[model samples]
Target: MNHKEINSFYTYLQSQQTSQRFLYQCYKKIDGIDAEAKSYENCTVFMYYLDHGIKFYNAGKKLDILMQPILFFYGMVHLLKACLLTKRPNYPESTSVLAHGVSARKRKKKDYTFLEDEVKVQHNGLFPYVSQHLFFIHKMPFEKIMMKNLLGLIPDLSHLFHFNNQESMINVSKIGSHTIDFTSRVLDNYHLTERAFLERIKPYLPPIVEVKSNHTMFQIVLTKPILEPSGPFFVDDNQNIFFPTIRENFLVVSEVMVHYLLLYNLSMLSRYEAEWWGDLLITKPDVDYPFIAEFLRISAKKMPLLIGKELLKMK
Candidate 1:
Protein backbone atom coordinates (compact mmCIF):
# COMPACT_ATOMS: atom_id res chain seq x y z
CA MET A 1 0.00 0.00 0.00
CA ASN A 2 1.05 3.61 -0.62
CA HIS A 3 1.60 6.23 2.08
CA LYS A 4 -1.82 7.82 1.49
CA GLU A 5 -3.60 4.48 1.76
CA ILE A 6 -1.65 3.43 4.87
CA ASN A 7 -2.20 6.83 6.46
CA SER A 8 -5.95 6.55 5.82
CA PHE A 9 -5.96 2.98 7.16
CA TYR A 10 -4.31 4.08 10.41
CA THR A 11 -6.74 6.94 10.69
CA TYR A 12 -9.48 4.39 11.30
CA LEU A 13 -7.75 3.44 14.57
CA GLN A 14 -8.61 6.89 15.95
CA SER A 15 -12.08 5.65 16.84
CA GLN A 16 -12.19 4.59 20.49
CA GLN A 17 -15.06 2.18 19.92
CA THR A 18 -13.36 0.53 16.97
CA SER A 19 -9.99 0.29 18.72
CA GLN A 20 -11.68 -1.19 21.81
CA ARG A 21 -13.44 -3.82 19.74
CA PHE A 22 -10.23 -4.67 17.92
CA LEU A 23 -8.22 -4.84 21.14
CA TYR A 24 -10.95 -6.84 22.82
CA GLN A 25 -10.66 -9.57 20.19
CA CYS A 26 -6.86 -9.45 20.17
CA TYR A 27 -6.61 -9.69 23.98
CA LYS A 28 -8.94 -12.69 24.05
CA LYS A 29 -7.21 -14.44 21.16
CA ILE A 30 -3.60 -13.69 22.11
CA ASP A 31 -3.59 -13.78 25.89
CA GLY A 32 -7.04 -15.00 27.05
CA ILE A 33 -7.44 -11.78 29.04
CA ASP A 34 -10.75 -10.21 30.07
CA ALA A 35 -11.05 -8.73 26.62
CA GLU A 36 -13.73 -6.15 27.25
CA ALA A 37 -12.23 -4.78 30.47
CA LYS A 38 -8.67 -4.58 29.17
CA SER A 39 -9.79 -3.13 25.85
CA TYR A 40 -11.84 -0.48 27.57
CA GLU A 41 -8.83 0.74 29.50
CA ASN A 42 -6.23 0.36 26.76
CA CYS A 43 -8.03 1.46 23.59
CA THR A 44 -7.42 5.17 24.06
CA VAL A 45 -3.75 4.61 24.78
CA PHE A 46 -3.45 2.33 21.76
CA MET A 47 -5.04 4.94 19.53
CA TYR A 48 -2.67 7.57 20.90
CA TYR A 49 0.35 5.35 20.25
CA LEU A 50 -0.63 4.84 16.63
CA ASP A 51 -1.54 8.52 16.28
CA HIS A 52 1.82 9.63 17.62
CA GLY A 53 3.59 7.19 15.30
CA ILE A 54 1.86 8.49 12.18
CA LYS A 55 2.51 12.08 13.20
CA PHE A 56 6.22 11.38 13.58
CA TYR A 57 6.28 9.60 10.23
CA ASN A 58 4.49 12.49 8.52
CA ALA A 59 6.84 15.06 10.05
CA GLY A 60 9.90 13.02 9.05
CA LYS A 61 8.94 13.35 5.39
CA LYS A 62 9.47 17.14 5.51
CA LEU A 63 12.81 17.00 7.31
CA ASP A 64 16.35 16.70 5.97
CA ILE A 65 18.26 13.40 5.91
CA LEU A 66 20.20 14.48 9.00
CA MET A 67 17.00 14.49 11.10
CA GLN A 68 15.04 11.69 9.45
CA PRO A 69 16.56 8.79 11.43
CA ILE A 70 15.57 10.26 14.81
CA LEU A 71 11.98 10.81 13.72
CA PHE A 72 11.67 7.51 11.84
CA PHE A 73 13.21 5.45 14.65
CA TYR A 74 10.82 6.82 17.27
CA GLY A 75 7.94 6.58 14.85
CA MET A 76 8.76 2.93 14.34
CA VAL A 77 8.96 2.49 18.11
CA HIS A 78 5.47 3.88 18.65
CA LEU A 79 4.00 1.66 15.96
CA LEU A 80 5.82 -1.32 17.43
CA LYS A 81 4.51 -0.42 20.90
CA ALA A 82 0.99 -0.29 19.51
CA CYS A 83 1.56 -3.74 18.01
CA LEU A 84 2.88 -5.02 21.35
CA LEU A 85 -0.25 -3.76 23.14
CA THR A 86 -2.37 -6.01 20.94
CA LYS A 87 -0.40 -9.06 22.08
CA ARG A 88 0.91 -8.23 25.56
CA PRO A 89 -1.92 -5.86 26.67
CA ASN A 90 0.17 -4.62 29.61
CA TYR A 91 3.22 -3.41 27.69
CA PRO A 92 5.96 -1.57 29.61
CA GLU A 93 5.36 -4.07 32.40
CA SER A 94 8.69 -2.86 33.78
CA THR A 95 11.15 -0.02 33.26
CA SER A 96 13.46 -2.33 31.32
CA VAL A 97 10.86 -2.99 28.63
CA LEU A 98 10.88 0.70 27.71
CA ALA A 99 14.56 0.78 26.71
CA HIS A 100 15.60 0.68 23.03
CA GLY A 101 16.45 -3.01 23.66
CA VAL A 102 19.66 -2.88 21.61
CA SER A 103 23.00 -1.08 21.87
CA ALA A 104 25.89 0.07 19.69
CA ARG A 105 29.60 -0.03 20.49
CA LYS A 106 30.49 2.46 23.22
CA ARG A 107 33.19 4.01 21.06
CA LYS A 108 34.05 3.90 17.39
CA LYS A 109 37.56 3.19 16.16
CA LYS A 110 39.38 6.02 14.37
CA ASP A 111 38.82 4.52 10.92
CA TYR A 112 35.31 3.12 11.61
CA THR A 113 32.97 2.77 8.68
CA PHE A 114 29.16 2.74 8.91
CA LEU A 115 28.84 -0.55 7.04
CA GLU A 116 31.25 -2.21 9.43
CA ASP A 117 29.48 -0.89 12.53
CA GLU A 118 27.43 -3.33 14.60
CA VAL A 119 24.70 -3.47 17.25
CA LYS A 120 24.25 -6.02 20.01
CA VAL A 121 20.79 -7.26 20.96
CA GLN A 122 19.88 -6.74 24.60
CA HIS A 123 18.03 -9.13 26.91
CA ASN A 124 15.23 -6.75 27.88
CA GLY A 125 13.62 -3.77 26.23
CA LEU A 126 11.36 -2.98 23.31
CA PHE A 127 13.38 -4.92 20.71
CA PRO A 128 13.17 -8.40 22.19
CA TYR A 129 9.71 -7.73 23.61
CA VAL A 130 8.27 -6.79 20.23
CA SER A 131 10.17 -9.61 18.55
CA GLN A 132 8.77 -12.27 20.86
CA HIS A 133 5.26 -10.87 21.41
CA LEU A 134 4.38 -9.43 18.04
CA PHE A 135 6.54 -11.42 15.61
CA PHE A 136 7.16 -14.59 17.62
CA ILE A 137 10.94 -14.29 17.15
CA HIS A 138 13.18 -15.17 20.09
CA LYS A 139 16.58 -13.59 19.63
CA MET A 140 19.69 -14.51 21.60
CA PRO A 141 20.70 -11.79 24.02
CA PHE A 142 23.84 -9.80 23.06
CA GLU A 143 23.90 -11.37 19.60
CA LYS A 144 25.83 -9.00 17.36
CA ILE A 145 24.86 -8.04 13.77
CA MET A 146 26.79 -5.98 11.27
CA MET A 147 25.40 -3.06 9.25
CA LYS A 148 26.33 -4.71 5.94
CA ASN A 149 24.32 -7.84 6.72
CA LEU A 150 21.23 -5.89 7.75
CA LEU A 151 21.35 -3.73 4.63
CA GLY A 152 21.67 -6.83 2.45
CA LEU A 153 18.50 -8.25 3.98
CA ILE A 154 16.28 -5.53 2.58
CA PRO A 155 14.92 -6.76 -0.77
CA ASP A 156 14.41 -3.22 -2.06
CA LEU A 157 18.09 -2.53 -1.59
CA SER A 158 19.29 -5.80 -3.10
CA HIS A 159 19.71 -4.26 -6.53
CA LEU A 160 21.83 -1.48 -5.09
CA PHE A 161 24.05 -4.09 -3.52
CA HIS A 162 24.20 -5.91 -6.83
CA PHE A 163 25.26 -2.71 -8.59
CA ASN A 164 28.07 -2.51 -6.10
CA ASN A 165 29.13 -6.06 -7.17
CA GLN A 166 27.71 -7.87 -4.17
CA GLU A 167 24.98 -10.49 -4.61
CA SER A 168 22.77 -10.49 -1.52
CA MET A 169 19.54 -12.16 -2.66
CA ILE A 170 17.85 -14.34 -5.23
CA ASN A 171 14.38 -13.36 -6.43
CA VAL A 172 11.66 -15.98 -5.96
CA SER A 173 9.15 -16.20 -8.77
CA LYS A 174 5.60 -16.36 -7.49
CA ILE A 175 4.10 -18.88 -9.92
CA GLY A 176 0.60 -18.75 -8.45
CA SER A 177 -1.24 -17.59 -5.37
CA HIS A 178 -0.07 -20.66 -3.46
CA THR A 179 3.18 -21.54 -5.20
CA ILE A 180 6.64 -20.04 -5.70
CA ASP A 181 9.49 -20.97 -8.03
CA PHE A 182 13.24 -20.40 -8.02
CA THR A 183 16.06 -21.63 -10.20
CA SER A 184 18.11 -24.70 -9.38
CA ARG A 185 21.01 -22.30 -8.94
CA VAL A 186 19.67 -21.72 -5.42
CA LEU A 187 20.29 -25.38 -4.64
CA ASP A 188 23.70 -25.08 -6.23
CA ASN A 189 24.42 -22.04 -4.08
CA TYR A 190 23.69 -24.07 -0.97
CA HIS A 191 25.11 -27.29 -2.44
CA LEU A 192 21.93 -29.12 -1.51
CA THR A 193 19.76 -31.52 -3.44
CA GLU A 194 16.04 -30.77 -3.77
CA ARG A 195 15.15 -33.05 -0.86
CA ALA A 196 17.93 -31.65 1.30
CA PHE A 197 16.94 -28.10 0.41
CA LEU A 198 13.35 -28.77 1.47
CA GLU A 199 14.49 -30.09 4.84
CA ARG A 200 16.68 -27.05 5.47
CA ILE A 201 13.91 -24.57 4.65
CA LYS A 202 10.98 -26.47 6.18
CA PRO A 203 11.76 -25.12 9.63
CA TYR A 204 11.61 -21.53 8.41
CA LEU A 205 8.68 -21.42 5.97
CA PRO A 206 5.01 -22.30 6.17
CA PRO A 207 3.79 -25.83 5.63
CA ILE A 208 4.49 -27.18 2.20
CA VAL A 209 1.80 -29.01 0.29
CA GLU A 210 4.05 -30.41 -2.45
CA VAL A 211 7.09 -29.75 -4.59
CA LYS A 212 7.56 -29.82 -8.35
CA SER A 213 10.91 -29.71 -10.05
CA ASN A 214 12.85 -30.07 -13.29
CA HIS A 215 16.57 -29.79 -14.04
CA THR A 216 16.46 -25.99 -14.22
CA MET A 217 13.88 -24.94 -11.60
CA PHE A 218 12.09 -25.99 -8.42
CA GLN A 219 8.55 -25.10 -7.47
CA ILE A 220 7.34 -24.97 -3.89
CA VAL A 221 3.62 -25.30 -3.35
CA LEU A 222 2.38 -23.93 -0.05
CA THR A 223 -0.66 -24.98 1.91
CA LYS A 224 -1.81 -21.34 1.99
CA PRO A 225 -0.88 -17.96 0.63
CA ILE A 226 2.21 -16.35 2.17
CA LEU A 227 0.67 -13.27 3.79
CA GLU A 228 3.90 -12.09 5.43
CA PRO A 229 7.65 -12.64 5.46
CA SER A 230 9.20 -15.77 6.94
CA GLY A 231 12.77 -16.86 7.62
CA PRO A 232 15.03 -15.99 4.72
CA PHE A 233 12.06 -14.95 2.60
CA PHE A 234 11.00 -11.28 2.54
CA VAL A 235 8.39 -9.29 0.63
CA ASP A 236 9.57 -6.77 -1.94
CA ASP A 237 7.96 -3.48 -2.96
CA ASN A 238 5.56 -5.39 -5.21
CA GLN A 239 4.67 -7.63 -2.25
CA ASN A 240 6.37 -10.65 -3.80
CA ILE A 241 8.71 -12.75 -1.66
CA PHE A 242 12.45 -13.22 -2.23
CA PHE A 243 15.22 -15.25 -0.60
CA PRO A 244 18.62 -14.21 0.67
CA THR A 245 21.52 -15.60 -1.33
CA ILE A 246 23.40 -16.46 1.81
CA ARG A 247 21.92 -18.81 4.42
CA GLU A 248 22.62 -17.51 7.92
CA ASN A 249 20.88 -17.16 11.28
CA PHE A 250 20.25 -13.49 10.63
CA LEU A 251 18.16 -14.69 7.70
CA VAL A 252 15.58 -15.52 10.36
CA VAL A 253 15.43 -11.83 11.31
CA SER A 254 12.22 -10.28 10.03
CA GLU A 255 12.43 -7.18 7.85
CA VAL A 256 10.67 -5.14 10.55
CA MET A 257 13.28 -6.13 13.13
CA VAL A 258 16.08 -5.41 10.68
CA HIS A 259 14.75 -1.89 10.15
CA TYR A 260 14.49 -1.38 13.90
CA LEU A 261 18.14 -2.38 14.46
CA LEU A 262 19.47 -0.19 11.64
CA LEU A 263 17.34 2.76 12.70
CA TYR A 264 18.32 2.43 16.34
CA ASN A 265 21.99 2.57 15.45
CA LEU A 266 21.45 5.41 13.00
CA SER A 267 19.41 7.41 15.50
CA MET A 268 22.15 6.95 18.10
CA LEU A 269 24.83 8.05 15.66
CA SER A 270 22.75 11.04 14.59
CA ARG A 271 22.17 12.07 18.21
CA TYR A 272 25.57 11.32 19.85
CA GLU A 273 28.05 11.05 16.98
CA ALA A 274 26.87 14.20 15.24
CA GLU A 275 30.30 15.12 13.92
CA TRP A 276 30.77 11.75 12.21
CA TRP A 277 27.18 11.69 10.95
CA GLY A 278 27.55 15.19 9.52
CA ASP A 279 30.87 14.36 7.87
CA LEU A 280 29.48 11.17 6.37
CA LEU A 281 26.55 13.04 4.82
CA ILE A 282 28.23 16.33 3.85
CA THR A 283 31.67 15.07 2.86
CA LYS A 284 30.52 11.90 1.08
CA PRO A 285 33.68 10.37 2.43
CA ASP A 286 32.81 6.76 1.68
CA VAL A 287 30.46 4.38 -0.18
CA ASP A 288 28.04 4.31 2.78
CA TYR A 289 26.27 7.51 1.66
CA PRO A 290 24.30 6.11 -1.29
CA PHE A 291 23.22 2.95 0.51
CA ILE A 292 22.37 4.87 3.67
CA ALA A 293 20.46 7.52 1.77
CA GLU A 294 18.58 4.92 -0.23
CA PHE A 295 17.76 2.98 2.92
CA LEU A 296 16.48 6.08 4.73
CA ARG A 297 14.19 6.79 1.80
CA ILE A 298 13.01 3.21 1.45
CA SER A 299 12.49 2.67 5.17
CA ALA A 300 10.47 5.87 5.45
CA LYS A 301 8.04 4.52 2.86
CA LYS A 302 8.18 0.75 3.45
CA MET A 303 8.09 0.43 7.26
CA PRO A 304 4.52 1.79 7.46
CA LEU A 305 3.32 -0.62 4.79
CA LEU A 306 4.85 -3.55 6.66
CA ILE A 307 3.29 -2.34 9.92
CA GLY A 308 -0.02 -1.77 8.16
CA LYS A 309 0.08 -5.32 6.85
CA GLU A 310 0.68 -6.58 10.38
CA LEU A 311 -2.27 -4.55 11.74
CA LEU A 312 -4.51 -5.80 8.95
CA LYS A 313 -3.70 -9.40 9.85
CA MET A 314 -5.09 -8.74 13.35
CA LYS A 315 -8.44 -7.92 11.80
Candidate 2:
Protein backbone atom coordinates (compact mmCIF):
# COMPACT_ATOMS: atom_id res chain seq x y z
CA MET A 1 0.00 0.00 0.00
CA ASN A 2 2.74 2.49 0.96
CA HIS A 3 6.49 2.70 0.34
CA LYS A 4 7.27 1.83 3.95
CA GLU A 5 4.95 -1.15 3.80
CA ILE A 6 6.46 -2.37 0.51
CA ASN A 7 10.00 -2.16 1.91
CA SER A 8 8.94 -3.88 5.09
CA PHE A 9 7.31 -6.76 3.24
CA TYR A 10 10.38 -7.30 1.11
CA THR A 11 12.55 -7.29 4.20
CA TYR A 12 10.22 -9.81 5.89
CA LEU A 13 10.35 -12.16 2.92
CA GLN A 14 14.11 -12.01 3.00
CA SER A 15 13.82 -13.14 6.61
CA GLN A 16 12.07 -16.45 5.78
CA GLN A 17 14.45 -19.15 4.63
CA THR A 18 11.96 -21.80 3.35
CA SER A 19 9.33 -19.50 1.89
CA GLN A 20 11.75 -17.20 0.05
CA ARG A 21 13.86 -20.05 -1.27
CA PHE A 22 10.89 -22.12 -2.52
CA LEU A 23 8.97 -19.14 -3.94
CA TYR A 24 11.91 -18.26 -6.19
CA GLN A 25 12.19 -21.85 -7.39
CA CYS A 26 8.46 -21.94 -8.13
CA TYR A 27 8.69 -18.74 -10.20
CA LYS A 28 11.22 -20.35 -12.59
CA LYS A 29 8.97 -23.38 -13.07
CA ILE A 30 5.81 -21.26 -13.35
CA ASP A 31 6.41 -21.55 -17.09
CA GLY A 32 4.27 -24.72 -16.81
CA ILE A 33 4.93 -28.23 -18.12
CA ASP A 34 8.48 -29.18 -18.93
CA ALA A 35 7.67 -30.27 -22.49
CA GLU A 36 11.31 -30.81 -23.26
CA ALA A 37 11.30 -33.47 -20.57
CA LYS A 38 11.62 -37.03 -21.81
CA SER A 39 8.72 -39.43 -21.94
CA TYR A 40 8.90 -41.97 -19.17
CA GLU A 41 8.76 -45.67 -20.00
CA ASN A 42 7.97 -46.82 -16.47
CA CYS A 43 6.23 -45.42 -13.38
CA THR A 44 9.48 -45.75 -11.43
CA VAL A 45 11.37 -43.82 -14.08
CA PHE A 46 8.43 -41.49 -14.55
CA MET A 47 8.17 -40.99 -10.81
CA TYR A 48 11.88 -40.34 -10.67
CA TYR A 49 11.67 -37.51 -13.17
CA LEU A 50 8.52 -36.41 -11.39
CA ASP A 51 10.39 -36.36 -8.10
CA HIS A 52 8.40 -34.01 -5.81
CA GLY A 53 11.32 -31.84 -4.81
CA ILE A 54 13.74 -32.43 -7.68
CA LYS A 55 12.12 -29.78 -9.92
CA PHE A 56 12.86 -27.29 -7.22
CA TYR A 57 15.70 -27.83 -4.77
CA ASN A 58 15.94 -31.26 -3.14
CA ALA A 59 14.42 -30.71 0.30
CA GLY A 60 17.16 -31.11 2.87
CA LYS A 61 15.02 -32.94 5.44
CA LYS A 62 12.79 -35.99 5.41
CA LEU A 63 9.16 -35.24 4.64
CA ASP A 64 6.54 -36.12 7.25
CA ILE A 65 5.34 -39.73 7.59
CA LEU A 66 1.63 -38.89 7.23
CA MET A 67 1.70 -37.92 3.54
CA GLN A 68 1.79 -41.28 1.70
CA PRO A 69 -0.73 -43.25 3.80
CA ILE A 70 -3.20 -40.46 3.12
CA LEU A 71 -2.52 -40.30 -0.62
CA PHE A 72 -2.30 -44.04 -1.32
CA PHE A 73 -5.61 -44.69 0.38
CA TYR A 74 -7.01 -41.76 -1.61
CA GLY A 75 -5.68 -43.15 -4.89
CA MET A 76 -6.93 -46.59 -3.95
CA VAL A 77 -10.35 -45.02 -3.47
CA HIS A 78 -10.33 -44.21 -7.18
CA LEU A 79 -9.82 -47.89 -7.88
CA LEU A 80 -12.94 -48.53 -5.85
CA LYS A 81 -14.83 -46.04 -8.00
CA ALA A 82 -13.77 -47.95 -11.10
CA CYS A 83 -15.45 -51.05 -9.71
CA LEU A 84 -18.76 -49.29 -8.96
CA LEU A 85 -19.66 -49.82 -12.60
CA THR A 86 -18.02 -50.42 -15.92
CA LYS A 87 -16.65 -47.00 -16.92
CA ARG A 88 -14.54 -46.01 -19.87
CA PRO A 89 -12.57 -42.85 -20.50
CA ASN A 90 -14.21 -42.75 -23.95
CA TYR A 91 -16.95 -44.96 -25.36
CA PRO A 92 -17.52 -46.82 -28.63
CA GLU A 93 -19.92 -44.35 -30.32
CA SER A 94 -19.42 -41.19 -28.24
CA THR A 95 -17.34 -40.27 -25.19
CA SER A 96 -18.89 -39.09 -21.92
CA VAL A 97 -19.40 -40.16 -18.30
CA LEU A 98 -21.48 -43.33 -18.37
CA ALA A 99 -21.02 -46.73 -16.73
CA HIS A 100 -22.05 -49.77 -18.76
CA GLY A 101 -23.64 -53.05 -17.63
CA VAL A 102 -20.29 -54.77 -17.87
CA SER A 103 -20.87 -56.02 -14.38
CA ALA A 104 -21.13 -59.78 -14.80
CA ARG A 105 -23.18 -60.19 -11.66
CA LYS A 106 -26.96 -60.54 -11.93
CA ARG A 107 -27.03 -57.29 -9.99
CA LYS A 108 -28.05 -54.12 -11.80
CA LYS A 109 -26.72 -54.35 -15.31
CA LYS A 110 -26.02 -50.63 -15.61
CA ASP A 111 -25.59 -48.60 -12.43
CA TYR A 112 -25.00 -44.89 -12.31
CA THR A 113 -24.18 -43.21 -9.07
CA PHE A 114 -21.36 -41.37 -7.32
CA LEU A 115 -20.18 -41.64 -3.74
CA GLU A 116 -17.61 -39.90 -1.52
CA ASP A 117 -16.68 -42.10 1.39
CA GLU A 118 -13.30 -42.34 3.07
CA VAL A 119 -13.56 -46.05 2.34
CA LYS A 120 -10.84 -48.60 1.62
CA VAL A 121 -12.54 -51.44 -0.16
CA GLN A 122 -12.73 -52.80 -3.71
CA HIS A 123 -15.57 -51.95 -6.10
CA ASN A 124 -17.34 -55.26 -5.52
CA GLY A 125 -16.84 -54.87 -1.81
CA LEU A 126 -19.20 -51.91 -2.01
CA PHE A 127 -22.12 -54.28 -2.49
CA PRO A 128 -23.64 -55.84 0.62
CA TYR A 129 -24.32 -59.21 -0.99
CA VAL A 130 -20.87 -59.38 -2.58
CA SER A 131 -19.17 -58.56 0.70
CA GLN A 132 -21.50 -60.67 2.84
CA HIS A 133 -22.59 -63.92 1.16
CA LEU A 134 -19.63 -64.17 -1.15
CA PHE A 135 -17.25 -63.28 1.65
CA PHE A 136 -16.20 -66.90 2.12
CA ILE A 137 -17.42 -68.50 -1.13
CA HIS A 138 -15.31 -66.03 -3.09
CA LYS A 139 -12.22 -67.87 -1.89
CA MET A 140 -13.29 -71.28 -3.13
CA PRO A 141 -12.50 -73.15 -6.36
CA PHE A 142 -16.15 -72.77 -7.32
CA GLU A 143 -15.70 -69.03 -7.65
CA LYS A 144 -12.65 -69.57 -9.85
CA ILE A 145 -14.59 -71.85 -12.18
CA MET A 146 -17.45 -69.40 -12.13
CA MET A 147 -15.12 -66.65 -13.27
CA LYS A 148 -14.11 -68.77 -16.27
CA ASN A 149 -17.71 -69.63 -17.22
CA LEU A 150 -19.50 -66.46 -16.13
CA LEU A 151 -17.24 -63.69 -17.55
CA GLY A 152 -16.93 -60.27 -15.87
CA LEU A 153 -18.47 -61.94 -12.82
CA ILE A 154 -15.96 -60.31 -10.49
CA PRO A 155 -15.29 -56.78 -11.68
CA ASP A 156 -13.30 -55.17 -8.88
CA LEU A 157 -12.18 -58.08 -6.73
CA SER A 158 -10.95 -60.19 -9.65
CA HIS A 159 -8.48 -57.55 -10.71
CA LEU A 160 -7.33 -55.75 -7.61
CA PHE A 161 -3.62 -55.79 -8.51
CA HIS A 162 -3.77 -54.74 -12.16
CA PHE A 163 -2.33 -51.25 -12.66
CA ASN A 164 -2.07 -51.03 -16.44
CA ASN A 165 -5.09 -49.02 -17.53
CA GLN A 166 -4.72 -45.24 -17.41
CA GLU A 167 -8.45 -44.68 -17.85
CA SER A 168 -8.99 -46.85 -14.79
CA MET A 169 -7.03 -44.45 -12.59
CA ILE A 170 -9.00 -42.42 -10.08
CA ASN A 171 -10.58 -39.17 -11.24
CA VAL A 172 -9.92 -36.26 -8.90
CA SER A 173 -12.36 -33.50 -7.96
CA LYS A 174 -10.72 -30.11 -8.45
CA ILE A 175 -12.02 -28.39 -5.33
CA GLY A 176 -11.98 -29.87 -1.79
CA SER A 177 -13.79 -30.02 1.54
CA HIS A 178 -12.58 -29.07 4.99
CA THR A 179 -12.63 -31.53 7.92
CA ILE A 180 -10.80 -31.67 11.20
CA ASP A 181 -10.12 -35.44 11.10
CA PHE A 182 -11.60 -36.77 7.87
CA THR A 183 -9.24 -39.67 7.35
CA SER A 184 -10.73 -41.76 10.14
CA ARG A 185 -13.12 -44.56 9.20
CA VAL A 186 -14.46 -47.34 11.40
CA LEU A 187 -15.26 -50.59 9.59
CA ASP A 188 -17.31 -53.11 11.58
CA ASN A 189 -14.44 -55.52 12.26
CA TYR A 190 -11.39 -53.40 11.44
CA HIS A 191 -9.77 -51.01 13.90
CA LEU A 192 -7.05 -49.15 12.02
CA THR A 193 -9.06 -46.23 10.67
CA GLU A 194 -7.19 -43.06 9.64
CA ARG A 195 -8.31 -41.02 12.66
CA ALA A 196 -6.85 -43.69 14.91
CA PHE A 197 -3.72 -43.73 12.79
CA LEU A 198 -3.19 -39.97 13.16
CA GLU A 199 -3.54 -40.31 16.87
CA ARG A 200 -0.65 -42.75 16.86
CA ILE A 201 1.55 -40.09 15.29
CA LYS A 202 0.23 -37.21 17.38
CA PRO A 203 3.09 -37.32 19.83
CA TYR A 204 5.51 -36.74 16.97
CA LEU A 205 3.77 -33.62 15.64
CA PRO A 206 4.99 -30.32 17.00
CA PRO A 207 2.60 -27.60 18.20
CA ILE A 208 3.08 -26.06 14.75
CA VAL A 209 0.60 -28.62 13.39
CA GLU A 210 -2.92 -27.29 13.92
CA VAL A 211 -5.10 -29.53 11.77
CA LYS A 212 -4.47 -32.63 9.65
CA SER A 213 -6.43 -33.19 6.49
CA ASN A 214 -5.59 -33.17 2.77
CA HIS A 215 -2.60 -31.04 3.53
CA THR A 216 -1.16 -30.22 6.90
CA MET A 217 -2.87 -26.93 7.73
CA PHE A 218 -0.69 -24.60 9.75
CA GLN A 219 -1.84 -21.79 11.99
CA ILE A 220 0.61 -18.94 11.61
CA VAL A 221 0.79 -16.76 14.63
CA LEU A 222 3.38 -14.00 15.08
CA THR A 223 5.99 -16.57 16.08
CA LYS A 224 5.35 -20.31 15.65
CA PRO A 225 7.53 -22.71 13.71
CA ILE A 226 5.64 -23.36 10.48
CA LEU A 227 6.67 -26.58 8.78
CA GLU A 228 5.58 -26.91 5.17
CA PRO A 229 6.40 -29.81 2.88
CA SER A 230 7.11 -27.18 0.23
CA GLY A 231 10.75 -26.11 0.36
CA PRO A 232 13.49 -24.85 2.60
CA PHE A 233 13.21 -21.93 5.04
CA PHE A 234 10.28 -20.42 6.96
CA VAL A 235 9.57 -16.76 7.56
CA ASP A 236 8.58 -15.03 10.78
CA ASP A 237 5.37 -13.01 10.63
CA ASN A 238 4.64 -9.77 12.40
CA GLN A 239 0.84 -10.32 12.43
CA ASN A 240 -1.35 -13.33 13.23
CA ILE A 241 -2.92 -15.31 10.37
CA PHE A 242 -5.16 -18.36 10.32
CA PHE A 243 -6.09 -21.61 8.53
CA PRO A 244 -3.08 -22.19 6.26
CA THR A 245 -3.33 -25.72 4.86
CA ILE A 246 -1.71 -28.02 2.27
CA ARG A 247 -3.47 -30.20 -0.29
CA GLU A 248 -0.27 -32.10 -0.91
CA ASN A 249 0.31 -32.93 2.75
CA PHE A 250 -3.32 -33.11 3.97
CA LEU A 251 -2.28 -30.84 6.83
CA VAL A 252 -4.03 -27.72 8.07
CA VAL A 253 -2.44 -24.75 9.80
CA SER A 254 -4.56 -22.01 11.36
CA GLU A 255 -4.02 -18.67 13.02
CA VAL A 256 -1.12 -17.73 10.81
CA MET A 257 0.18 -14.33 9.70
CA VAL A 258 3.20 -12.13 9.48
CA HIS A 259 3.94 -8.75 11.12
CA TYR A 260 2.63 -6.58 13.91
CA LEU A 261 3.81 -3.51 12.04
CA LEU A 262 5.56 -5.67 9.36
CA LEU A 263 3.99 -7.69 6.45
CA TYR A 264 4.43 -11.10 4.73
CA ASN A 265 2.92 -13.66 2.36
CA LEU A 266 3.30 -17.46 2.11
CA SER A 267 2.76 -19.20 -1.22
CA MET A 268 0.11 -21.93 -1.45
CA LEU A 269 1.28 -25.43 -2.37
CA SER A 270 4.60 -26.52 -3.62
CA ARG A 271 5.20 -28.31 -7.01
CA TYR A 272 1.79 -29.71 -7.85
CA GLU A 273 1.47 -33.38 -6.81
CA ALA A 274 -1.55 -35.01 -8.43
CA GLU A 275 -0.79 -38.43 -6.98
CA TRP A 276 -1.34 -37.09 -3.51
CA TRP A 277 -5.10 -36.66 -3.77
CA GLY A 278 -6.02 -37.66 -7.31
CA ASP A 279 -7.33 -40.90 -8.80
CA LEU A 280 -5.40 -43.57 -10.74
CA LEU A 281 -5.92 -44.35 -14.43
CA ILE A 282 -4.18 -46.53 -16.99
CA THR A 283 -3.43 -44.03 -19.79
CA LYS A 284 -2.01 -46.56 -22.21
CA PRO A 285 -4.58 -48.99 -23.63
CA ASP A 286 -2.42 -52.10 -23.45
CA VAL A 287 0.52 -52.57 -21.12
CA ASP A 288 0.20 -55.73 -19.03
CA TYR A 289 -2.71 -57.84 -17.82
CA PRO A 290 -6.00 -56.80 -19.40
CA PHE A 291 -7.59 -59.43 -17.20
CA ILE A 292 -7.43 -59.63 -13.39
CA ALA A 293 -6.88 -63.22 -12.26
CA GLU A 294 -4.50 -61.82 -9.65
CA PHE A 295 -7.20 -59.74 -8.02
CA LEU A 296 -8.60 -62.84 -6.32
CA ARG A 297 -5.60 -62.82 -4.03
CA ILE A 298 -6.70 -59.48 -2.56
CA SER A 299 -9.44 -59.46 0.06
CA ALA A 300 -11.10 -56.36 1.45
CA LYS A 301 -9.19 -56.83 4.67
CA LYS A 302 -5.90 -57.12 2.80
CA MET A 303 -6.25 -53.76 1.17
CA PRO A 304 -5.55 -50.22 2.58
CA LEU A 305 -3.37 -51.78 5.27
CA LEU A 306 -1.43 -53.84 2.73
CA ILE A 307 -0.96 -51.01 0.29
CA GLY A 308 -0.66 -48.38 3.01
CA LYS A 309 2.28 -50.21 4.55
CA GLU A 310 4.07 -50.40 1.21
CA LEU A 311 3.54 -46.70 0.42
CA LEU A 312 4.88 -45.70 3.81
CA LYS A 313 7.98 -47.84 3.30
CA MET A 314 8.71 -46.03 0.03
CA LYS A 315 8.87 -42.77 1.91
Each model's lDDT comes to 0.84, 0.23
Candidate number of the best lDDT:
1
lDDT of 1 by residue, 103-179 (tens): 89988889989999999998998889888887777864338988998998898998998999988887784423687
| Model 1 global lDDT (CA atoms, 0 to 1) | 0.84
Which ten residues in a row are the worst by lDDT in model 1? Answer: 170-179
User: What stretches of model 1 exceed 4 Å from their correct place?
Assistant: 1-6, 30-32, 204-216, 221-225
Model 2 lDDT at residue 164: 32
Clashes (candidate 2): 46
> What TM-score does candidate 1 get on C-alpha atoms?
0.91
* Candidate 1 pairs with clashing backbones: none
Q: What is the C-alpha lDDT profile of model 2 across 6-72, one tens digit per residue?
A: 3343233233342233233323343452222211112222232223212211221133222322322
